[model samples]
Target: MYLIEYLKSADSLTIQLSLTLLFVVVYIIVTKLTDRIIRRFGRKNEIALPRVVYTIKYFRFVLLVFILLLLGITWDISFEGLSVYFLSFFTVAGVGLFASWSILSNVTSAIILFFYFPYRIGDRIRIVDGDNSIEGIVFDLNMFSIVIKNEHGQKVTYPNNVALQKAIIMLK
Candidate 1:
């Protein structure tokens, strides 16, 4: 009864507030539903990789951000006033990411190796490095480097980026 009367008498500001609340509720429901579905799929497939898990989280974040942006536009939040700040922030972020290129490349290679690498742990293999070809058993796989125990019993840790670039031979 009170709610009906309020809605009937709602001014422009009140109506706008109600719409904003509705959008937020919808966004929350969508984000939660998507997360639950992805969680179920991950559990069913036994997806334990950080790459896949992070991708899902990033996707949800991006979706929520897009929804928020839409809501901002709907409520007349001024992008013109914020554009310069966004540009400055991105420029700084670009430089930082560029400075960490090597680390980033190795991490990217690790993701590729996780999905497409054929060799298993304990497999004997040779990475064709010309004068310093490495022949060893695969000891361990890490996010940045792969560890192999060479013939002389010394463990060699090669960056994953290099591993992806070199040709590998399985010696069985």
Candidate 2:
């Protein structure tokens, strides 16, 4: 057919190289734009924009991978081949993500808590969830846990994720 003839006659290598170069240029421009935007907005706000920065970085990485795949396709690489390549990579990434889901979730919650100012160190806080109750002064806030010292002088450590989920009452 005419389509087959056109495909065979097309300069696939040239197309691939051009696309690769274009992708690189676009990526650089996007990164600069994102940095400028984040700086402009984030500076005006009281809280630091770690999540936004992380999201932009992740997006850039994904875009770079997409561009590379496009380059391969333009050079007459088959979709089946690409799928096989990405499948293994995705499988490994998925397993790692699954294994670390709890940690990641807790870290994300901690980031939100940091910006929200729900409770701070040295603040008296009462956490009541069903029959479990702990009234204490927050001593430390770390990545994994929040350390609190109760009236009985007992140091209690609650996982960050668990602390975020419960209702916290601040007392003067």
Candidate with maximal TM-score: 1
Per-residue lDDT tens digits of candidate 1, residues 1-110? Answer: 99889889998678778878988888889878877776675565544445456545655778888888877776887899889998999899889889877787887787
lDDT of 2 by residue, 1-172 (tens): 9856765776867556766787789878977886677556545543345544654565576677877777666667787867987899989988997987777777666655654645667789998877888899988776566789999999998777888788889999
Give all candidates' CA lDDT scores. Answer: 0.79, 0.73
CA lDDT for candidate 1? 0.79
Tell me which residue pairs clash in candidate 2. Answer: none
What are the per-model C-alpha RMSD values against the true structure?
A: 5.9, 6.6
Q: What is the lDDT of residue 7 in candidate 2?
A: 52
Worst 10 residues of 2 by lDDT: 42-51
State TM-scores per candidate: 0.55, 0.52
Q: Clashes per prediction?
A: 0, 0
Best by lDDT: 1
